[model samples]
Target: MNAEFVAVFVGSSIRFAAPLMLASTGELISERAGVLNMSVEGMMLSGAFLGAAGAWATGNAALGLAIGMLVVLPIALLQAFLSVTLRANQIVTGIGINILALGATTLAYRELFGERSSAVIPGLARWSPPGLGAIPVIGEPVFHQVWLVYLGLAILLATSLVMRRTALGVALHAVGAAPRSVDQSGLSVTRLRYGAVLFSGVMSGAAGCFISIGDIHTFTEGMTGGAGYLAIAAIIFGNWKIGRTVGACLLFGAASALQFQLPLIGVHVPTALLVMLPYLLALIAVAGLIGRQTAPLALTQPFRR
Candidate 1:
């Protein structure tokens, strides 16, 4: 492909990956802290619905984003309560929550915007670094993006630092590996795990908002689709490491972008196949095709103390 085509492809990849990057960052931390956090998909869907609804209602995308993130706290708390406090089956609880969120969002969308389905929702503005947007052929297409893309990168950097270079990071890692030891060290395993899951929820909320108010500027029932699951797949593909996880997200994003790009290039690959590429890679990762996975010792185990 030509330079401009390549630049557009690169830009589309980043845009598609932005939400995955946001959600996976939090999911990585949550998984590291030993909570399976299956409800990420549900949390994302809820956020997307709430964010879009709020933006449409108030004509303010920022407030909508805030509402989306804030609203997910309770859902995250519910996930934490079930997985941590009540020690419920993490996978089942997460799947159930996902189903519930799907139904609830679909119904709510119908009730709130049934008559005005075409109403334009305010979307977040695109931005580029001071000089990045001024470059020649690759400038705008490659650099201009929703502000959330930059924010997600910042959060990813901060999370990596916190995960690698701080006492809290050590505690989080320790809690997942050996909760008994964490408790012995006078730390509350329950508290750490809960906090991690809550953080994951907030990130998922932002990710959902990115889809509804940042990129699409609109919402539809179940708009999150399977992005949350894709985020989890990204974590597995990256072997639970932050840097590798980002790479995985970008890879999946490129696969998504190809669904549009290939058609333009007169490569009429099945759209379904392009859409399935990420999940297919996810399955390969889970099947141990890429490499051996080293998960946290107590990833889904409940802590009692």
Candidate 2:
């Protein structure tokens, strides 16, 4: 409504979008490498749990963040091994991993926290770019974000450059679209897919850590709450491109912010609709923009050689 409100809204939108942006970047790469990693949700959950636990135990959010990212590698490896080596059904494997992560995280939380659920954990520090923080009304409110947000943006830019302008990027793209050709060319499709899945796991872990530590400064059972799926939907909505996918994440974040803003502005919108808006838009975008087209030619297909 007002300038101040608008700034807050915009800032909140960015915060909400950061995780999806991070996860989507990783997913894009994994999919580009011909591995349809379905377990991003589970990976994110594991990261959140591990990151939070590490932070609480060490009293250092940075250490927690590192631990979270490190711990998710095994899960990612499992996904890659199943989808890449065994040629398991990607969707089933991903869903199964998600279920397992949810149960495990819940049980672990109960066991670790016990009655100390209300205790506080150290959160990531917040910082704003020097010049950007100086603006009058909109600057601080919008730019003073957790440092991880900045880190994520940097990673996004680096990913964009790598995806658009690098030999390895070409290899990744080739692996997804023409794995047989890649294999024939002496590249190991298996290795490429494994690397991509591992990268996705690391990014998912970072994203999850952002939620549990950077944003909430705490952990709760099932904290990811479908955000992982949202990231996948974001990839579909973005048509697998980095720039468009980032935009899609921001759009979803704005939709999420509206749930709170609408009430404040005296706009009588249904809560359910506001919450469902992002998913609905993603579905529509996918349907309208992706009809009849297909993903990478070799996506989910294991290399025979």
Question: In candidate 2, residue 64 scores what lDDT?
Answer: 98
Using TM-score, give the best candidate's number: 1
Best by lDDT: 1
How does model 2 score by TM-score?
0.97
Residue 272, candidate 1: Cα error in Å is 1.8
Once fitted onto the true fold, the runs of candidate 2 whose alpha carbons sit more than 4 angstroms away are 289-294
Ten contiguous residues with the weakest lDDT in model 2: 285-294
- RMSD values for the candidates in order, in angstroms, are 0.9, 1.4
Give the Cα-based TM-score of candidate 1 against the true structure. Answer: 0.98
Q: For residues 1-305, what per-residue lDDT tens digits would candidate 1 score against the true structure?
A: 78999999999999999999999999999999999888999999999989998898899999999999999999999999999999999999999999999999989988998935966799999999999999998899999999889988999999999999999999999999999999999999989999999999999999999999999998888888899999999999999999999999999999899999988879998888998988898788778899999999999999887
